[model samples]
Target: MLRHLAVRTRFFDDYLLHAAADGGCHQVVVPAAGLDTRAFRLNWPPNVACYEIDAPEMMAFRERVLAGQAAEPAVARRVPLAADLRGEWTKALLGAGFDPAERSAWLVEGPLIHLEAAESTRLLGEIGDLAAPGSRLALAHGLDPGEAAGPDSEPGSGPGSEPDGDPAGAPRPPGSAPEEDPAAWLTHHGWRATRHDRAAAATSYGRPPGYLTPRLSYLTAERRPPAVAPAVQGRS
Candidate 1:
C-alpha cells in the first residue's frame, strides 16, 4: 500500500499542494480521501481548514491509525468526515457546520475516473457553488483521445511486461475513465482555468525515463469573482 501510494503522492497530489500555495487559498477539501496525509504534512496557514471526506470504513481506519500514533494534525482544523460522495452528502456536511462562504482550494485526485460525468458535474457544481469568489481547484484529468492519446492508445508500459494484462497488447485504462472531456466540461461549467497537458507532465513528473504514457492531465482553476460593477446601458 505504501509503495503504490507513494508513487501517486509524488506524481499528481504534489501538484495540488503547489496550487494551494501559489493560489493562496484558505480551505481545502479532499474528496474520496483514501489515505492522504496532507492535513499533517502540508504547512497550512493558521486560519485554514483541511477537510477529508471519505467512506465510513476508510474514515474509521484513518481515525484508528491517527489515534494509535497519537497524531494531532498539524493543520489548523483537521476535519475527517465519514460520508459517501455519491449520496446527499451536502446536508450531512453542512449539518456538521461547513460554511458555504468559506473559500477553498481543492484537490480531486484519483476519483474522477471512477465516477460518471453527471456525477462529477454534480460534485463540481456543488463545490463551485459553495466556493467563495476567486477560490481555486486543482484536479488530475485523464484525457479523451486528444492530441495526447488516452489510456486506450495501446502504448507499452515503459518496457515492462504487462503485469496485469497481456504484454503485447494495449495499455490498460486506469479503472473506468470517462471518454467525455471532463476538464473542458468543468471549464464550461464556470471554472476559469488552464491545464498541464500530457507533454508537460511527462517532462516534469516522469522526467528521467518519462511516464509510460502521460494518460493523465492536471488542471487548476479559480472561481470567477462577482462582477466588480454591473454593465450600465448607454455607457458610450
Candidate 2:
C-alpha cells in the first residue's frame, strides 16, 4: 500500500509542480504538508514564494530532517506555518504572509479521507473563499484497492480527459456508496474542474499497470474570473 501511495504521490507532485510553475503564480500553499519537499527539489521561479501548512511537530521533524541535508529551497521564500487545519488555519496562513488578493496555487494531498464529510466540505469552502480568481487547486486521495478496476473502466481516455470520462462520474466498486462528486462540488463553488483517474494518470506518468490502484483520483480546478458587465452607451 505504501508503495502504491508513493507512486501516486510522485505523479501528483509532478503535476502540481508544473501547474504552479506554468501558471506563473507568485504564491503556493501546501496544506497538511507532511514530509514532502518540493520547495527544495523543484526549479521554481526566483520570484515565487511557497508556504507549507502542517502541525508544529511535523514542521519540527521536517526541519530536523533538512538540517542534515545541504539542499536549499529553489524559491525565493519558503515559509512553514504550523497550524491545525481544523481551527483558524486561515488566520495562521495569512499571518505567514499569504495574500488572499493574489492569485495562488493550493495543493491538498493525502488528507481528505481523514476528514469527515462535513469537515471536508468546510475545508473546501475555506479554500474557495481564500482563493482569488485564476487561483488553482489540486486535490488527491488514496482509495480502497481495486475500487476502480471494475468492469466500467473506460479505455482510450488519457489522464487529461475533459468531456467523456470525468472522474466524478466514474463507477465505484460494488457495495461502495458513491462519493460526493468532487468535480461537481467544486463547480458549484465556482471552480472549473477536470479529473484524472488513477489508471490514466499512471499511464501518463509512464508507470506500468499495477503501479497504482484505479481508486486513486486527482482533480485540478481553477477559480473562474468574475464576469464583467457590458458598458451602457450614452444617448447620442
lDDT of 2 by residue, 1-236 (tens): 67567666776677667767687567889989999788888877667889998989998888888887866888889998888888899999998888999989988876677777777877888898999998988887444222446745544334776732245465433223213556666766668877667777766667787665566667778888866899999998
After superposition, the stretches of candidate 1 with alpha carbons farther than 4 Å from their true spots are: 1-8, 11-14, 18-22, 148-179, 209-212, 226-236
lDDT of 2 at 15: 64
Candidate 1 global lDDT: 0.64
lDDT (Cα, tens digit) per residue for candidate 1, span 100-143 = 78667778877777778668767777777777776777676655
TM-score of 2: 0.81
State in Å the error of residue 222, model 1. Answer: 1.2
If scored against the real structure, what TM-score would every candidate get? Answer: 0.74, 0.81
Query: How many clashes does each candidate structure show, in the order listed?
Result: 0, 0
Q: What is the lDDT of residue 192 in candidate 1?
A: 63
- Decoy 1 TM-score against native: 0.74
Locate the minimum summed-lDDT window of 10 residues in model 2.
Answer: 170-179
Q: Give candidates' CA RMSD values in order.
A: 8.7, 5.0
